[model samples]
Target: MIEDRPYTGLFVLDAGQGVAGPCCGMLLAATGAEVVKLEPPEGDWSRGLSVRKGPESVLHAAWNRGKQGLVLDLKDPAGRAAAQALAARADVLIESFRPGVAARLGLGPEDTGPDAICLSISGFGQTGPYAERPCTDAVAQAFGGLAALNQGADGIPHKTGPFVTDVMTGFAAFAAVQTALAARAQDRAAGRPPRRRVLDLSLLAGTAMLLASQIGEAALLGHSPGVPNVPAGCYQGSDGLWLMVTLVRDPDFVTLCRVLGLPPLAEDARFANFAARSTHAAELVPMVRDAFAGQPRDHWIAALQAARMMTTPVNSPVDWLADPHVVAVGAAPASVQGALGAVPFPAVPGQPQPRGAAPLLGEHTAEILSRLAPVPG
Candidate 1:
């Protein structure tokens, strides 16, 4: 556990469902904020997503760790009143509703008082043609140009297997919240009243941020760069394990050729330099591929390292979990929740590992709501 708990006294109202907003709230919880996850009567939709055990599902565990739960049906007047009361006292409020849904429920930033920081996460953004349209990670990837840039060996653009865009949006939202918190703190120190801060983040915006360089290249260069490096891709060995190889300079290509026992190809005019190799890639790459096919991945890995070339085995999730370096660094730490058992999650690079399991539906409702009750005369 990290000893630095900066947000120890801060209260965060997390009225977000699914992944993006929950992820930011989870980070706040890890940093010692008192986060209350506001779910509907059926609980957060993520609780029913995949592999549910009791009140928690894999999605909930992955994104809602370390937060308390409050079940509130926004459509119900009483429930909406309870949420509004909580938001009024909150230091930060996070929601993932479509454009005007939060305002309709009276939980929008304008309703959360003047000093509260509000973060709204959505598919496109708050004011856009698609603001009201629903979207998911897959939709964001396809619509935000990520799929277009992630071309596969088969020449088909494929959305990543994981929910990368949603996670990216979460990270972006977290950063924005931190910035707002810092600014608010500065205002307090300077003896000035802080105004309300509203942050709008979207999956499409996050995807665009992730592909910033690619977007710049497309617009500035007016065409794709097409394969930045020749022969620097995945190659399958005889053992059927794929290894990724990369060459940064002309000498690295020489080293790769030497490692593959194709020293003559390094001197051959047709494949001598980066330009030549790129031009003749259709011919030269096959020769390198055939050479890699002659040996197991382990053999090529050894030879490539011995020659001081950049290379690594293409790792699956299982392989990553068992990787020696990952183990040494404690990259993925397991959090044990009763009944749910131990769940391994990647540790945030500079942040503390989350301390608790996701809360059960409305787990802290009674205790939390009682605090919001009016004082007796």
Candidate 2:
């Protein structure tokens, strides 16, 4: 078993309620940080997301594990004071409000400890002209050119289902926080005062960076490869299930044809090279799809594996839960106890156990406030 390293008791002040900021806090907490999630008296907006038992919703539980919860009305003077007190002692502060909101609350980087690292995640950025505009993940993706790459053959753009911008921003914020922490540690070792830093992490910027390939194509070739590169999509298997294939090399294309029992495709001029394969993808994909459709998913999967061609069936939640490899790697556990009953939550990667369910709202409020109270003289 891999030994788990406990977080060295770094404090995190999570003032943001939604996916972006909370996800950052959650990652920190997973590494053993003491994350204090401050929500309004009514609770974080996500807490009321579903009719789950108590104040914990499915979304809230998934994003807020390993963190303590506190309720404070930021609009109230007392609430603001409590928040500032927490911020002063915190090592990291993550907020995802519109630009200027944290500053107005007096909880911005300048208002916190000099050593504190502040991560301000927003739709645009702090200094951008559109910083104050309210935006969602889809809007950010569109603004960042991700939606442009998602256009279909019809040339109409479509939104990706998941909130990619928010998720990517969360990951970026976590990285920035870790970098700040490392820098602060170095400063302390050198006997210099730890410098406070404010990271302006924009969802739009994060999404744009994630589209490096698309951006590079436009810059170098003067045109964007609108959809996924050819030979990198779902293909039909003989047994009616879909198998996704990604052939990055001409050799892999050869192996792909061999796996399908077609040797002539590799010799054909149109499908000979990667560039040619891409140009003739319309012709090649139908052939490959039709060949795959001739066999069952398992037979093709085995054949692809035998040829060392990258492949997998289109996996659903059910497929993942029942997969032998997933079970062997402990990706999905047997069951999880929730307020409703025992439900299955996927296992943690490289860990023996899945994380516990999120704590009840304000479950530790009394104990935490008591610890913070001044000692009697």
Candidate 3:
């Protein structure tokens, strides 16, 4: 099946660690490329990133799955020779070292030749005032102003769970590479000489791009985006289950009031218009909350949904994983036999079921080195 893939003939050398760089290689492998993950004698630090099972960690296994693993300490002269040799033969080379590290190791554009595409993933990109600063997912979020979008009622912001910035950079890198390669292909076919291009992406830029809408609202409207002037917010039901409700159009308030058995709210002079309802939100919210507190969440969800109001339970991750809609979508398995027992992968549109499990540290070192060995005359 891999042999018949879109990138069957492509070769990718992944020298990056953790989520961003490995994710880029994982994406390439999914499309049928032969991806060789270059690691050191100590292995990728991500091997210890999550709980371990035997020789592999779930996080390491999930992200590094579907690639051949090769261990070479580029800090050593011999290791650098092997790394440069591999880079010289690769179609694509991806790294996440600090700005100048790859060039110092001889794996940069000059070494990869004019046809190879080199993608550099960093926290603040290769050229910036903060280029030398070390950054991780949380650091990028805070610096990129992504945390501002996740503020609570107290106005205190929070970094999101897991590697949001790192993962976004991976998605961005994939798209950028495809665009660059397509343009290169066109250029070469038109008789223009091929030139090696270095693609630079930063977690800062990727995370900022994801916050475009929220930032736009803050910049253009002088306020953060929010549900404007309506009876809308999360409320606790009788069973203590939380659900969100929204009144979008003016008529939605009428529908909501009728559903909650408070039909008079629609015509009450004190709460007649959107402005009145907003002004009296503190007064109105409790009435709605009390009405819901008399019933289980499902009852309100059903009634509000039937009335065409936007309402939904604030489902937990576990609830969403078992949701009927999620099952019907069918992109992910309930669980996979990962290096660390049965681990789950996130549901992504069009992601091929992992064709291979994660490789052990230096697992394919012998296999890869033999392939790169010089030919005998």
- Pick by lDDT: which candidate is best? 1
Name every residue pair that clashes in candidate 1: none
Q: Give the runs in model 1 whose Cα sits over 4 Å from its true position.
A: 268-276
TM-score: model 1 vs. ground truth: 0.95
For candidate 3, report its TM-score: 0.88
- Each candidate structure's TM-score, on Cα atoms with residue i matched to residue i, is 0.95, 0.89, 0.88
RMSD of 1: 1.7
Deviation (Å) of 208 in candidate 3: 1.2
Compute the lDDT of residue 182 as modeled in candidate 2. 86
Q: Write model 2 residue lDDT over 274-350, tens digit each, in one string.
A: 77777888898778777878888889888888888888989987888888998787665544335735555654444
Residue 194 Cα positional deviation in candidate 3, in Å, after optimal superposition: 0.9
After superposition, the stretches of candidate 2 with alpha carbons farther than 4 Å from their true spots are 1-6, 50-54, 151-156, 226-229, 333-356
Q: TM-score: which candidate is best?
A: 1
For residues 1-377, could you state the per-residue lDDT of candidate 1 as single tens digits?
Answer: 44687899999999998999999999999999999999998888888887767766887889988998898888989999999999999999999999889988978987886878999999989997889989999999999888877888798999999889989999889899999999998988998976999999999898999888888878987975456678899999999999999988988888888788889998999877787888888998889999999999999998898888889999998999999999998999999765578988899868876789888889899999999988899
Candidate 2 or 3, higher TM-score? 2
The CA-based lDDT of model 2 is what? Answer: 0.77
Report the C-alpha lDDT of model 3 over 1-377, residue by residue, as the tens digit: 22345677888999999899898888888778899999888888888877787778877876777888888988889889989988998889999999999989978888896778899998898996999999999988988777876786688999987788888899788888777778888988998988887899999898988888777878987876553656788888899999999766788888888899999888888778777887687788788889989999999999988877888899987787788987787635644445466666774455554467777778898988888787999
Ranking by lDDT: 1, 3, 2
